[model samples]
Structure formats: C-alpha cells, structure tokens
Target: MSLFILWGAVFFTLALVFYSVGIWNDYCHKQLKKWHITMFGLGVLTDTLGTLLMYLHVGYLIFTAHSISGFLGLFLMMSHFCWAFLAIRNNDLQLLNNFHRFSILVWSFWMISYISGLYLGINGLG
Candidate 1:
C-alpha cells in the first residue's frame, strides 16, 4: 500500500480506540465528563484526518457503501460530541447521566462503517 493509505489506516485505528474508550468509559460511569468529550473530539479529528488521507490516496470520491456509511458515521459522531458538550455545559443531570445511551448508538453505527472500511481495504476494493 502507499504511504497515504498506510497512514490513513493508522489514524482510523486510533479513531476507533479513542471513540471506543470514550463511549465505554462514559457508559461505565453512567455520566458524561470532559475527558470523554475530549476523547470524542480526538476521535472526530483522527477520523477526519484518516478520511482525508484516504481520499488523497484514492484521488477521487466513489459512492460505495463504505463511503456513504463513513459520511453518516462522521455526522453522527460530530452530533454526539456536540450533544455531550451541551449536556455538560447546561448542567442537565438527566442528559448527562443518560447520554451514554445515545453514545452507544452512535458508536455502534460508527463501528459498522469502520468495519466495512476494514473489509474493503483488506479485500483491495476500497
């Protein structure tokens, strides 16, 4: 694989790790925290970097299932991050406590895209 593709894979894996740790930690604690939000932000940033690197490697966009799901996953992740911030900023106890549910849902969706990308990459189809 090219350097861009290799670096993209590394960043994507980091996104997975950051996102999973954030969501899992928040769920286990049953509360939203600034650290979890930071993780989420890092996840988004790394995922974006990975996507951009992959795009550079590809030289163009292709509307495959992986690409579409990736776009949706990115949107969900951004939304989740913003909601977590808002929940903390507003000091909404209910939202802060229950935000893990939404986080899990978004994480699940994001995982689907992540897994699909991995499949595509491994099969040399991406």
Candidate 2:
C-alpha cells in the first residue's frame, strides 16, 4: 500500500476510536458533556485528514458506494458535532439528556460506512 493510504487508514482508525468513545460514553452516562464534544470534534478532524489523504492518494474522486457512504458519514458526524455544541451552549437539560439517541443513530450510520470501506479495501475495490 502507498504511504498515503497507510496513514489514511491509521487516521481513520483513530477517528473511529475517538468517535466511539465520545458517543458511547455519552450514551452510557445519559448526558452530554464538554469532553464528549471535544471527542466529537477530534473525530471529525481526524476523519477529514484521513479523507484528504485518501483523495491525494487516489489523485481524483470516484463516485462509488464506499465513497458516497463515507461522504454521508462525514456529513452526519459534523452535524452531530454541531448539534452537540448547540445543546451544550443552550444548556437545555432535556436536549442534553436526550442527545444520546441522536448520537447513537449517527454513530451507527458512520459505522456502516466505516465497515463498508473496510470491506472494499480488503477486496481491492475501494
């Protein structure tokens, strides 16, 4: 594999770890916290870096299922992060408490994209 692909994979894995920890911790605690928001931000940052690296390696964009899902997942992740920021900023108790449901849904969709990318990568179809 090229160095770009290797580093991209590493960053993507880091994104997964960061995102999972953030979302699952919030879910388990049943509350939104600043730290969780930090994690979500890190997840988005890492994912973006990974995506950029992959794009550089590929030299162009290809509209495939994996790519489409990845874009969607990234969008959802960013939206989730923004929502979390808004909830925290607004300090709405109900919103903070109930945010886990949305977080989990977003996380699930992100996981689907992640897994699909993995499968495609393994099959040399990504």
Candidate 3:
C-alpha cells in the first residue's frame, strides 16, 4: 500500500479507538446526554470502513463517504463540546438550542475541504 493508504488506515483505527472510548464513557457514566456519543460510534464505524477500503486501494467510495462522514461526526462533536461548555456557563439548555448554528458553519467549511481533498486524491491529482 502507498503511504497515504497506510496513513489513512492508521488514522481510521485511531478514530475507532477514540469512539470506542466514548462508548465506554457513555456506558459507565450513565447520566450525560447521548446523541453526540452515539454520533462518535457511527462516525468511527464509517471512517474505519473508509480507511480499510483505502488500504485496498478502492477509489471514490471510501474517500467520498469518509469525507462526508468525518465532517458530520465532527459537527456533532463540536456541538456537544459547545453544549457542555454552555451548560457549565449558564446551567441551561438554551445555548444548546442554537448550537447548530456554529456547527453548521464549521461543518460546511470542513465538508468543502474534504470534498476537494477526495476529488484530488481520487483523480490522481493529490
């Protein structure tokens, strides 16, 4: 495998481990909100598949899917982070109601970058 594929695989594996940690945390903690934690697992699963496909040198499918998924996962994660912080600050859920506003903006930019990267990589332009 090329370096990129190997690196991608490694990265994906790392993400899987991280998400697994989140799952364990959720299971053990029992009281935290769960949407973002679930998102982590789903994200890790998708990304792991994507990275494995990359290792196999499959083009486009893994690249595009991973690109979209990574952005979505991170978007949820960012919202979770913001929510946690805001909850600490205001002791309320009001800020979380609007958390998506910032997450959308960040996700949009990240998606664009991921799409561009996938296009270049899949087209042999990377």
Candidate 4:
C-alpha cells in the first residue's frame, strides 16, 4: 500500500474509535458531556482527512458509490454533532436528548461508509 493509503487507514481507524466512543457515551451513559462532543468532532475531522487522502491518491476516479455515501455519512455526523453541541451550549437538555435519539442512525451511516470503504480499499476497487 502507498503512504496515503496507510495514513488514511490510521486516521479512519481513529475516526471509528472516536465515533464509537461518542455513541457509547450517548447511549449507554445517557449523559452528554464535553468529551462526547469532542469525540464526535474528532471523529468527523479524522474521517474527513482520511477521505481526502484517498481522494488525493486516486483523484476524480475515486468518486465511487462508496465515496459518495461516505461523504454523506460524514455530513450527517457533523450535523448531528453540531446539533448536540449547540443544544448543550444553549442549556437545552431536552433538545440534546432528542438529538441523542439520532445517534443510532448516525452510527449506522458511519459504519456503512466504513465497511464500504474497507471493502473498496481491500479489493483495490477505489
């Protein structure tokens, strides 16, 4: 694998871990915290960086179905993160909990992108 692929793998792995932490914190802990917000932000940022690296490596030809879905997933995750962050900042716990319900869908989309990307990368399809 090339350096870009290797680094992408590393950052995406971190993204997965961070996202998992955020989801777990939200669902299991049932409490919103600064660390949870940080984790979500970090996950999105890392995932974006990793995706950018892959895009750079393959140029426009890398715009596969998986990549498109991955970008959409990243967008939703970021939006959800921002929603939760703002809700917390505005002292709206009810809104925060309401947004927490969206975490499952966020996690699902993220994992779909992750699995699709993994498949593409492993099969040299990207």
Candidate 5:
C-alpha cells in the first residue's frame, strides 16, 4: 500500500511535469524543446529506477543501496515537481497557480516524510 502510494505519487508527478511543460510551451513561444523533455524524462525514469531498487532490498547491504537510491529518487522527484511549478510560475501560466502551489507543498511534505521513514527503517528503527 505504501509502495502504491509512492508509485502513484511518482506517476502523478510525471503527469504534472508533462502537462505543465506542454502548456507552457504552447502558450509561451513554444520554448520547451527536446532537450528539456529528454532531461525531464531521464530524471523521472531515474527516480522510478531508484524506487524499484529500494523495493528489491531484503538485507543490510542491499538495503543500504536501496535507502540511498530511494532518497536520491525522492530528491529527483522533488526536482521534477519544483521544475514543473517553476516553469508554470515563470510563464504566469495560471491554469491553476493556487492549486499547483498547494500540490507542490503537499508533495514536498510527503517526500520528506517518506524519506524520514526510510531512514529510520534502514537504521533498524522502523
């Protein structure tokens, strides 16, 4: 269930990134080019990869790598959210500025909580 939540968040974040960038490009001089798109894809893909890596661990050594990758993925996920919001905010692309801001905050909070929990779990405290 928690894994579902994490993956769900990742998918939602990816969708938001695509939508935000598409909207921005269409509305603001068609600026979101191939490079940005490719980078964004790689970032999200790496994030998902890291999550999967975390999911594969069952012991200390693997768990450590998993923990590190999980945190890295969360960081990348955060970057994606921030980038999407910033692009929209920069262009004043207010499809839902208030909503986006609220969403970003929620995502950030969740990421922090998730990472903290993973930290404790890795340290045998969970």
Candidate 6:
C-alpha cells in the first residue's frame, strides 16, 4: 500500500478502536465518565484526520456515493459528539441519556462508511 493509504488505515483503525470502546463503555457501563468523553473525542479526532488523509490521497474528488456517505457519517459523528459534550457541560445527564439513541444510528452509518472504504481500498489493490 502507498504511504497515504497506510497512514489513513492506521488512523481509521484508531478511530474505530476509540469509537467502539467509547460506545461500549457508555452503553454497558452506563456511566458518563470523563474517560467516555475522552474516548469519543479521540474517535472523532482520529476519524477526521483519517478522512483528511484519504481525501488528500484521492486528490479531493468527492462526488462518489461513498464520499457522500462518508461526509454524512462524519457529520453525524461530529454532531453526536458535540451534543454529548454540550449535554455533559450543561450538567444534563438526563438529556445525554436520551440523546444516546442517536449514537447507535451514527455508529451504524459510520461502520457502513468504514466497510465501503475498505472495499474500495481492497478493490484498488486488486
């Protein structure tokens, strides 16, 4: 793989790790801990970086269906993270609890984007 794909893959893997851990912790542990916030934040940050690297590698042509889904997924994740952060900052755990329903939706879409990107990468290799 090229360096661009390699680095993008690494960052995207980190993003998945962070997101999975955060979402699992939040759902299973049922806590609004700082670590949860940190994990989710890291997920978003890494995802953004990974996307940026991929975008650069792709020469900024983003008119494909996968690109649209990727953009939507990223936006959803960002919105979810921002909502959670604000809810926590405002001391509204109740609101946060209610808002978690959106988490699953965003995560599902994120996974779709990830899988599609992987398919694209492997197809490129082939």
lDDT of 1 by residue, 1-126 (tens): 899999999999999999999999999888678999899999999999999999999899988888999999999999999999888888888776667788899999999999998998899988
Q: Candidate 6 on 43-73: residue-level lDDT in tens?
A: 9999999888887887766678787888898
Model 1, C-alpha of 93: deviation from truth (Å):
2.7
Per-model lDDT: 0.92, 0.92, 0.53, 0.85, 0.49, 0.82
Candidate 1: which pairs clash? none
Error of 3 at 3 (Å): 5.1
Cα lDDT tens digits, model 4, 10-122, are: 99999999999998878887778888899999999999899888877777645567877888898998898898788879979778766667887888888998998888778
Model 2 per-residue lDDT tens digits across residues 15-78: 9999999999999988789999999999999999999999999999988878998999999999
RMSD of each: 1.1, 1.2, 9.2, 1.4, 10.9, 1.7
Q: Ten-residue segment with the worst summed lDDT in candidate 3?
A: 23-32
Clashing pairs in 4: none
Model 5: how far residue 30 lies from native, Å: 19
Ranked by lDDT, the better of candidates 1 and 4 is: 1
What would the TM-score be for candidate 3 when compared with the true structure?
0.41
Q: After superposition, which runs of candidate 2 have C-alpha atoms over 4 Å from their true positions?
A: none
Better of 3 and 6 by lDDT: 6
Could you tell me the C-alpha RMSD of candidate 2 in Å? Answer: 1.2
- List ranges where model 5 is wrong by over 4 Å: 1-43, 58-96
Off by over 4 Å in 1: none
- What residue pairs are clashing in model 3? none
CA deviation > 4 Å runs, candidate 3: 1-3, 6-33, 38-91
lDDT for position 13 in model 6:
87
